[model samples]
Target: MHDDEEMLRRLRVDDLPPSMVDLNRAMRAGRRRERMGAVVAGGLAAVLALGTVVVVAATTGKNTAAPWPGAGPEGSRSPEPAPPLGNCTIDEAPVASQSRMIKIVANRSGQVFVMQDPLKSGNLLRWMDGRQERIDGVPTGDGYGTAAAVNGSGAFVGASGYKPAWVYRDGTFTVLPLPPDVSAMSMVGINERGDLIGTAFYWDGRDDTRAVLWPASQQGTPVLLATPAGWSSEAMDIADDGTVVGYLSHRTDNGPVDITPMAWGLDGSARRLPVPAGWTPARAGKRGPYPIAIAGDWVVGAGARWNLRTGTAEVVEGLMPMKVDKYGRLFGNVPLSVPDNGSTSGRPAVWVNGDVQPLPIYPDRPEGTLFSVSLDGRRITGTSYVTSGAFGTATWTCGR
Candidate 1:
């Protein structure tokens, strides 16, 4: 694996809380499905070459790759059907050439914002009504441009270099002026009203980081969100209503770190979310419950969902809700444990009212992961790993 890819894998695996119970059952079912999937893997190279299927492969294979055990032609077991999304339909998005990987950063009202090549040479792309357009003119120093969030108005927030956060709107990239000392000022989330939130690092001797918010106009000075005493914080996401979600961690004398999930309001007020019941301490390689996405009345973290209205949090077994759409449908990955190696993998999954359903992967694809889901859950976007060893972006829409 490439150095960056290896680092990412380590981060993701390390982020998962320790293995839970019933993993054996889940693994058994997954292995059976994997076996079924392995049977038709060989024929997919042809389908991938045609590029006619919605879940298209990134490259054409040489037919030398070995299929899984019990291999056969396509339709050998009838591929798994897509999960139903009531009153919502999915439309596949076009894959851009040379786009090795994709991350659908945001979607609203059928308009999708995707960040192509999330790790290297990033480009901001938008999809709607069967047309895809790449927004040009994002600045870069030595590193590439990457977007973290988009608002309903089509304005996106990100950072170009260590010093300047940027807002891309209507084919223009505007610098978000900050103090000269601020570094690593990446915008993480934005709301429909064009309000944005992100973290800015101060390169003081301690290397502290704090959250900041920018208003829609981009005229006034950025507002710095509160950080607790002796704790450094990073704001990860923001809801349309201006609620910010992130984590708080303390480092004493550069020792072991402890993180606490946090939420901030429009007024810049901060509160620590109580750890859900039955929550266990993350093992040395695991991360504790940390909030990742915030939608109306809900905050999704590492292993649980917090209901802001009721002040109640529930544990989601085997799934960590990553993005919660407007209609409350949850999109994330299910961690799969391999009985042989004691290692784990993530399967793209969706949840409604605590019921989980794994998303379908193509016969030729080794794995898949979701990045964004539309408000009504009709559109889901993610990436699939093809047998040719390349990653391709995929969009799943509810169809008749």
Candidate 2:
């Protein structure tokens, strides 16, 4: 296996504490099992199975320096576009944990934020009223459950590694219901009305996955969103009006053939978002144009931004977009590549009126990524790493 693929497999499939020897053994065992399955199938199915493996490996690799999808609330709201970022100040927000923060999300008002520590302990920390407290209701196990998105009322939704997807509200946890023949599900984004969007995986092993919507009532069954016949879909973010945005990828015996941004309306109709002329997947760091967040008529992704009203997309140069607030301010990171060492670092930044304004980084914690931006464009939260390789959650409060 290639070095990157090997690293991704270890990170995604194995949750046990790191041990090089044990990880190697586990990889070998996994390969042996795949080989035996191929022998048992012994035909077209075998080829397709191998292709699916490749797709999973490619998609599962985590980009630590890029902002995760659904990092902040993007429910339907009037655009309160802010002026281009000007002179601002920066400071570190206090947190209760010393472990690495895996994900951070904020409510529409930015008054409440949730941070998850997935490395050392799987605890969800809620920051409000200038203090931090542990959220008590999320179920935990061997591995950490992801805290995907939160709404204005402080209700949040997420999925666990060993348990079903759930929503925590009013100091209680409620498990989301799954559709028939689906064994596993994950909730990624929730809107103001309590509508939830996520993905459902099948049990038949055809590698079938579909984007699903769970209504606000919590008792209603999830509705499967529409997709093309041979393609698979995953919903990343949902708007207050029930619009969902994500990506669709089609795979074959060779591998993933195409990946493009897509959206579903309130009626469950799928519409393909146009890409910039002459742009291709190879131009997007081999990941294609994956939409991470949607607000109003705008959808922002790694290196592309599309306007749903005009049906046009423009290239977002030098920015891996993480969050787009209702005010149209774009928050992201500029990845700095080190050619000699083949490593990459990021500088936290925001785009104002198509101009890039780089945020200040502390001398002690120089490398970091921006995860959540306040609706008013005043506060941004992310993780910063020290020279010793330890990281902590921080928030940068900016002002005029």
State every prediction's TM-score relative to the real structure. Answer: 0.70, 0.73
Clashing residue pairs for model 2: none
| TM accuracy, model 1 | 0.70
- Once fitted onto the true fold, the runs of candidate 2 whose alpha carbons sit more than 4 angstroms away are 1-82, 97-103, 116-123, 140-144, 217-219, 337-341
Model 2, residue 385: distance off in Å is 2.1
Best by lDDT: 2
After superposition, which runs of candidate 1 have C-alpha atoms over 4 Å from their true positions?
Answer: 1-91, 95-99, 102-104, 116-125, 217-219, 283-285, 336-343, 398-400
| Predicted candidate 1 versus true structure: per-residue lDDT over 18-103, tens digit per residue | 22222233442342233212122111110001111111111112111111112244231112232455433233446452334334
Model 2 residue 400 CA deviation (Å) reads 2.3
> Could you give candidate 2's per-residue lDDT for residues 208-315 as a string of tens digits?
568899877644688888765766677888887777998765554544345556777766556655555444444435456668887766678756676554344555
